[model samples]
Target: MLGQAVALLCLLAGDAGGLAFANAEPAWREKERLLENNKTLPCAASGTCSLGHTRQWTGDIYPLQGLRDCLRARVYRREIILVSENRLVAGFQLYDNMMQMGYDHIVLMSTEENCKRALRAWPQVSCIWSSQVFAATPKYMLDRHAFLPRAARLGVNVLCLDSDSMFLSDIYSHLKAPPLRDMALMALKDPAIGWLNSAVVYVQNARPDGPSVYVLNEVIDRLERWAEAREYMLGRNRKDFCWEQMAMSDILMSAVIGRPIAYGCWNWDRNVTYRDAWEGAHKRYFGYNETGGIGSWHFLKETKVPWPKSLAEHAPGFRRTEGVTHQQVIQIPNTQGVWPEEFGGPLYAPVRGNKSRAWMELIKSDGMPLWADPEDPAQAAANAANRELFTYLPEWIGIAYGQDGTSGYWNPALYRGANGTGTSPYALAHFYRLFGAPMNKLTVKMANNMWNWELSHLLHPRGGVFFASTEHAPIPDVLVYSPEVENREWVSHEEWDKATKALTRLAMEMGRTVVYPAPRCNLTWLGGERNNHLPLEIPMQFKHQCIPYSPSGKGFNDNRCMLGGYLMQGCMAARWYFAGGMFPPEYDHLVVHIRDKAAEHPVATVAAEQLARSWDSEELAKTLMAQHGGLGAGLFHPKIAEKLGAAAVPAVPAAAQKPRVLIIPSVLQLTDKVGPREQLYRDHEREDFNVMSCPWIQNKPFV
Candidate 1:
């Protein structure tokens, strides 16, 4: 008999995958076959079959078999079941929100047509047609009651969710506690009337005879009868619509039988239902507030609003200063010389100042006022004197005016070359004043050392390379840089040197000129080296290229006033430093100093013809020589040197044809500086790629 029962179960379990209540006919036939064979079946101790030992047990086997099949279908697990109808947009938002919280097994119960529409929108969702339950009562009253019996018969643990609710956190994980787990049904207590709110219902499929199904059927039958007498008892013109919650509350409140697992944390009503009780009793259990925490919210009145649009509307505003004068600005001290106390003592002022004091007063005390409103005559004279004095200072210590005409700040634009159109000439003149002689008297060895230093310390650390647009050009046209490499894992010194030399050679061959503009001053690769000392160990013969050209002998190197080598000639190296290596304006005024020079010289009128024609043919020849071993004897093979001069000079593209300006914008924003996203969007507006602010094209609805 046991063998026969096992054979029967194995046969029925084969079709268990298709054994829904809607398709129970095949399962019913299998149950009849088992009974006809007079096979003894497993039954619950309290069930009808156990009540009378003499009576035929055939009638009791069907429900038990149905339960077995339901269990076989693998429905008894953590699952989300939602009742939704025409609320397609709300449903989608709920589904999306659930997905964002990492809940995947979601089931939608609705009419066939509604289910079809929802499946079309989100094909990954599982749907069950439930319009038949709505035939007796209006959808809302029947919707919550309908899934319980069906889910029980299907042998699944279910979390019945309202379509309007948003799950803020993982509520399912909290339900595993012993006290909450022991209960067969769990829901939020309605604060308004002390009734159970059916917004969130957790049904545990533990009963072999399916007690939840029996209770749900009894509630539905009682409600159907109550619908007829409701109008007469209440003295109303029409039948009083019975809510499913009232039926569920009745069953839960009864003393005769089953009790529900009612906990405040599991079902928190957004309407603040039972707030005091929840706070006092279950708040510590859940560790969430009225507005926050918990697993889900019944957005009772929020059915009409879409989730994304609602979130956007309620997004917090950016904090802004009350008044312009109250706005704070940082003041940095001079690194080169003594700064006056009025301008804030030596490092930087910890406290911020208002615009008037930060902009006007600091400049007045710092020497001649560097930036002032042009409309004021005295201010203009101070600005002029500041610009004149900027030429006498180091190239790094210049400033440019802000987009607003009255303000001037630090600018990092590098003077790349005669063909380089973006750099400010005043910045270039200063660069020439410091390193003009060696740059003019170019050497292969000098260029190589400069290239090595720039590559190893700056470019390689940040995953950047100097790339020229023209073929086989020794010097790169622009520095293509990525700020993302700043936080990358530290590389060994040998690995860094190898990557630098390899990328330099590749950039030369590919005619690509680009370098990363790192924004921070503290380089992880440099370890603990002071700013005054060079990080790399240069050979004694190559130290001249590494050392700053301080003709005045006032210890420019001591203060680290000049960025050494011929890379400063075109200001390419200087621009890289300014973009990211320099400290923020609040901590360092180096950019402010650079921008002052840029404002005075302004890119447009600053010796364009002379600068454009000024290329060092001597530097170009030596660079080509160094490429094939003419400069350093042991650096290249003898055969490679023999073949060096035989190669013809690659034709330099006409200056007009060369891309004069190549802007490699920073990908990430600095904490103190204005974000680069907006500027990047504006720059790439005509390009094919999408910027951060633009709508995600793939997710957008079709026209």
Candidate 2:
């Protein structure tokens, strides 16, 4: 026991691959013992160590004891350890997010200098150098969780994720230990999908019975198959995703087979609002309401949980002014109160002049603003035009004041609600878009508001479900684009709106998210001539969008600053004055680029009243049609006679739950027989565990 403890402690104290344990008992025994006495272990600054905990384990787990000792964070000792991969733009934002949510044991695997410098100030935080994570290729996903085995070896459960995952409240509450199940999945029942984001994952022991290890192996196996089957990419930035989703989707949906293997969720929804860059960027102003009602907060069909209804009611009150920053109103802290009515909208700016200048941007001439120049036809015309156009947008696009009372990407409207504002916070949002530290007023206000709200919803055992629900990472329901037409001409808002209006109207009717082409930044329109348009980028309604200056790329990883992803986020909004279609590898359709000016015609975004039936052999299809309308998920032809039937039924959500199956061998018959619920259903059924219980037979979709 002492030898094993020394070995594990040695591993933490700059020893890599030096210890070889012949017996699992000793290693496993010390694993918990050291962890139990982790506080006594040497710390970074504490003189209790030999060489002082070194950085970069090369491929081993960098000693994480700094936080536990220096700041008493006891990071690895916590049952639910939160880990994330941090890169540029994702720095510090994720760290502050988890801390503000009050999660104590947090580690951000980041090598960026900014993250290192920033986190270095606080000994409570662990900033690790991780090259095996956030890889540019899908094959690297196997490396993504290499740290998990280390955590498992230490007997701690880990929740691994990407840096963009913004937690709304206390994730610790849902994930904190009591050992409810082998794995607590972050997904919804309806989608019946598992591993929604792949960014957020939870793991326990590496044993076969441990669901985390099982699911992870399955994900790696699936990725291995896909990687083998995949075509080679010609370029360096081969950004491919949705790798583990299909296989995990099969594993999670076993409830459809009446025998599920530890599928799970959190907080009623599977971590809602994964991806919402295009749609959410517009939600700062007004949006559609729930009940699919005709109201402002309409973040429909995006994820398991859409944007909360709490903020929707306040949307219309957000932007009183559009695209114009009021001189110098005090930038005040809006924490713990109703969302203050500061001016602004989550809308695009009219890029009609040079230097990416918005027509509404404060234009100074003769040392005075041009907005005051009524004599200037362009200024007068620009103001009139934007106001008239606002009514047509899918959601309100009030270009409002951001941080510092100037036009900024940080939208105040986003933090208006009191509950979970950031779902795993935001995924796929471009970095540098209103990004910074915990001190940022917007970050504080959002975190504080969620903490205040969570006061009422602490997890309770009698409350019924074992874990909280989570959702898929953000992915575009539909991607809308328009060619900037050789990067020379600009798409007029009228034409842009007309095209998007037609497209979004159709998509919404189909219950899908629809996007209109809104460039993150704009270019100058010089003398209406091709050669005259100097490529000077400027401040506009949408800031932080460096795409115009960035070299275009095929995907997210290709962008130099990670900014050039409009086709991958860029060039599409660059070249296409107008384009419409779903993003590639998921849905296939090329965007139809409309002419920049005077083009008022379009259609073909694919819309209908309902889904057209798609199926296999006519015999099965016909039988399904004749009986159950259509086969959903899968089908089991009225079976080879078991003389027994167990219908589909989801277990009711509970606050906490016991093991789904409690087995007793025949030789060891239980003194207490099966619970009355199990006894009653002995013929082939069990009592309701609620609608989502995996053990209960719900092999088919209720529909």
Candidate 3:
């Protein structure tokens, strides 16, 4: 019986071991399953919980689940992608608005240091150190391009926003379902330049298998290649490198299909004024309509101006101004403190008039004093002192008489004999006319002779004038003139240099001076018989002594400063006057004329046609005036032409009426050894030719 019992115990033990083994099968299977799940998680390979390559967010794969949960929880769901430097003062405001809009997932992308700093300030915000993935040094537009691909790679729907912008409403509600499906990227339209403003762009990356991310990468790559090519073409040192929006446009137009979010609905540029903002605030809504409810207000460079009082309550750091009369207040340095009422004007207002002051100072320092009455004892005494100070002033007569016996043709008498009339008195009389009262006959004659001597050297073929030192260099005073020449044969580098030297010497003898070349053909009426009527209003407003001639080129009759007549200072000054530099304003347009013989060949015919059309069209006249800030009218002044008995208004050609493009040729002379000016001309030529050759305008009306 004992032996049988022991055998039964052994059998029981064997059965127990088999049961244990069967139970262990599930545990082994569970271990394998866990390993598989871990492999699929983003951190499994890196052995960390973080997600993404460049956009390394915390909380591992679980955070992604949380994101899904957050999206499911929201009525109008979307993620916010904000790219900015850590030093951006408006970031907190942007973040507050995003939070108010119910965006739980806020991804901030910036340089590593910036990301760290931002995370310290706002611990709840997810930050991405872009420099970790993007090898290039971050630039304004380039940084945004670098981060956008990373956002797309995150496999989530996101709205990319500039740090300067703020959301006023649920932006997703404005987008319809069909348009959203068709759009890979949606951006607001820039009202001024008619391009897409990437400041507030919505990128759809909802599906795992979506082509948006891939397409975005492709677009970025293409843009980079294009930029490289452009750098090679224009040289890397070119300051006006293509911005990110330009690249975005090229990509969207060429590769990806996208839609422009309505200007009022999504992008409200600076054109939406403070008044509009206040009205919108009072209404408790934002747009671009009569109701004035803007979806997003891009303050742009106007950040220095204070927010309206009604809207200031919504922004945390913004404070309402006290005892201030101005429409806006400047933001003070301290976030909590208000900008003092005494300093509560526009930040630029104080500096806006600084340029005018500089101009006034320049005029005071360099401008010649007005001539006094010849009969006055004080005037006689002053003239005597000046003559003694500048012993060479009287020698100018000797110089004209060729008493020095120089070989070159600098004599006024020689020029008079050759050109048929005595040299123009306009240049010499210009200063006296501007600053001095009426002059005696002898004094006027002296002025006329001095002007004649200068003009002889300038227009004569054999003339040579050179600057002796920096003291004799040309002053910055401008005299604007048309690029047209009376004689094309006179257009040479030698003549150009001599003419410039003549003008420079005249300025030194007189005061600070500048010469401006008007890009288009027009006339101005200096006082005399022709000054009866003023065609444009700008000269009248400025109390100008000279007014623009009619676009018809009429007042040109008996005018020695006519298109092909003798070169005169009155004509040049008229150009300056028409270009908005009326006495007090600073003259910034300093240009030297270099004639291109090849280019000039076709210009004559086209110029005549354009001039005729310009004379007839009041619209063109207003356009020209507007172009120069309401300074002067069109390429051709009709009233002047009519007054001059040259009014032959031509019918607008069918081709000329279509949206015309003005081709502004370079004033620089290009040669084998290309300088900066020549290079600029070449670049402009390339751009202009490319634009002219566009297929869309092949048959369209154009100038």
Candidate 4:
């Protein structure tokens, strides 16, 4: 067979090296055991196994000296709960609750040495860390699949949970009870997205030595394929680990085996099913009004009852909250410095406010899509037809006020218990879908809950860049990209390279991390060239230059690109790319004077021009003074970093690094504190009047 034996003995436990997974199998031993049965392995026999040959991307933030200062992973029992190493305070809160429930064997992934700082700050809860922290890549996040195959081989069940998951009753009883306990692979049936949601998955490995192990191995095998495919297309891997859910859903016979039973109330304003289901139930229970009301969710085997219809089973069930501030949301000492004592819960997203909360019974089934990404018709519509009802009902858990991180709420009762209602509701709520699914800042007056503010984990806790249309003031942010060309002028995303390289170095050297914006929006590039889809990087970052925000919502490229109303959450530095975006005053600091201030020597400039024209990328690689370079003739160039000391950037001068482009990005954001927009506005109005009045243009063309 062309395929060789794979090796993922990559145990990230805090053991021999300090970042080792405690009690986990070592690399050499793991390799030996896995290979012992390699030829007969289920995945291998099926020809789907690729873990050994496929490369896993360890992302931007992955440090070399990791785990040197980390804590050891602790496993105590057969059942293990999994959570990725969260960077926020809510993560700590979730783990604390898990421990209090008297459960050990909780596994943590993406654990960096800095986690020691966070670990010491909270109660000591020993959990196994599968991998050190890495960002924007899946290797660390997908440690679930990496660990699951091992767990199945070892005969153990795994309950993977997100840090945002809320647990009220003990997690063990609810999941391991009657209907769900027996399933081989019971993924969170989110009928909303697909057949399964990996957020709250339960893998049954009781008979791991048999057919059940096949399912576990399948997930691992599929993930390897997905990773390989994504890497090939995007030239990099995405850390979202969305492929996990897709693979879980694709298990074919699994959903029939273990259908999900959804409990907690998801986003009321955002999801259509949650909205429709919630609205129907709320109205029947307490006479439909602006504010929602409470309801019961007792088992209806003919669970023909969808959502609030579950409320019908219990008559005369008027609920009450007996004046006790829910324990589940006791405010903790502020960790992110932005949180108020009033806020509490998994995320310190405020749970209490002037308006009381409400609930509705929701069912989990892979029926159809409950919600989807906003469409052009929906976004540009004059009325809120196919949109999230964010503001109409303040009772839908205190609708978000603005993007300033205020006006936030969470219902403690819904996630935990009904607190004097009929049957206890959801034991836990995975808060992956937040209050505002798409918090559109473009239309702020009617903006849905974008969770730009308040939601600590979603929005950047520390100040950073946020892109949107102007009419404000702020510190500052940066965007590096070129506008679509109008004429058949030559184009290159590589042209934008010099600016990004120089700026990235400056930012990182300043102790600022170059963090890419969240969910990077796609942009139009190499336009008018076969309408070519040229891109600097995939998941194109943040539009057109001449008509940036045209009414059609596509700018100047007809209906090619859509960009705006997005948040940037990196406390340190932001790596934003866009097509001549108008993201100036909104962010505080605008990028000015991008052109090289240092005058280049004529000899270096002449030499660079010749080098730029050279076809050999190998030669370019050798001269790649800052970031990109592969190999070849320019290798013996003089080292500039040696002579220039502190200020010098690798030894290359700007003129040498840049091509002989006609125009350079001298200024990034046009709007600034200097306030030139007012003058420009007057100039445009005057020009418009002149164009309208000039009757000469109306006459037939006179050659």
Task: For each candidate in the order shown, give its overall lDDT on alpha carbons.
Answer: 0.31, 0.28, 0.29, 0.29
Q: Write the per-residue lDDT of candidate 2 for residues 75-187, one digit (tens) a residue.
A: 33434444444332243445444443333355555544634553433333455543332222442344444455444434455666555344433333332322212233332
Q: Count the backbone clashes (under 3 Å) in each candidate.
A: 32, 62, 30, 25
Candidate 4 stretches greater than 4 Å from native: 1-77, 86-90, 100-104, 131-137, 225-242, 252-410, 413-424, 435-703
For model 4, residues 510-586, the per-residue Cα lDDT tens digits are: 21222112111223342333222111122213221110111112212331222222221111212211111222222
State the number of backbone clashes in model 3: 30
* CA error at residue 431 for candidate 1, angstroms: 64
Error of 1 at 78 (Å): 6.4
Which candidate's TM-score is highest? Answer: 4
lDDT tens string, model 3, 460-560?
A: 22321111001212222222223443212233333543343232222211122323221111223222332222111222212222211111112222112
Summarize candidate 1's per-residue lDDT along 1-703 as a digit string, tens digits. 1123324443444433222344445655775664444323212111211111121111111133432332333232334345453444444444444433333345455555766665443344445543332223675446446556545544466666655343323344334432244445555444345445565656664342333433444355435544445445245322233456665554443211111222321233435654454434433433345543222222111112112221122222212111100001111111233332221122112222243132223223323213233224444333233210000111111111111101000111111212322212111011111122323212111111111222111212332222111122222233222223322333543343333322222222223232322211123333223322222222333223232221112221212111122123321221111121111111111222224554321211112232233223233323333332232111122332353443322333332222211222222111222222223223433343221111111122111
Worst 10 residues of 4 by lDDT: 323-332
Q: Give the TM-score of candidate 1.
A: 0.27
TM-scores for all candidates: the values are 0.27, 0.29, 0.27, 0.33
List RMSD in Å for every model shown.
Answer: 33.2, 30.3, 36.0, 25.0
Model 3 weakest lDDT span, ten residues long:
388-397
Global fold similarity of model 3 (TM-score): 0.27
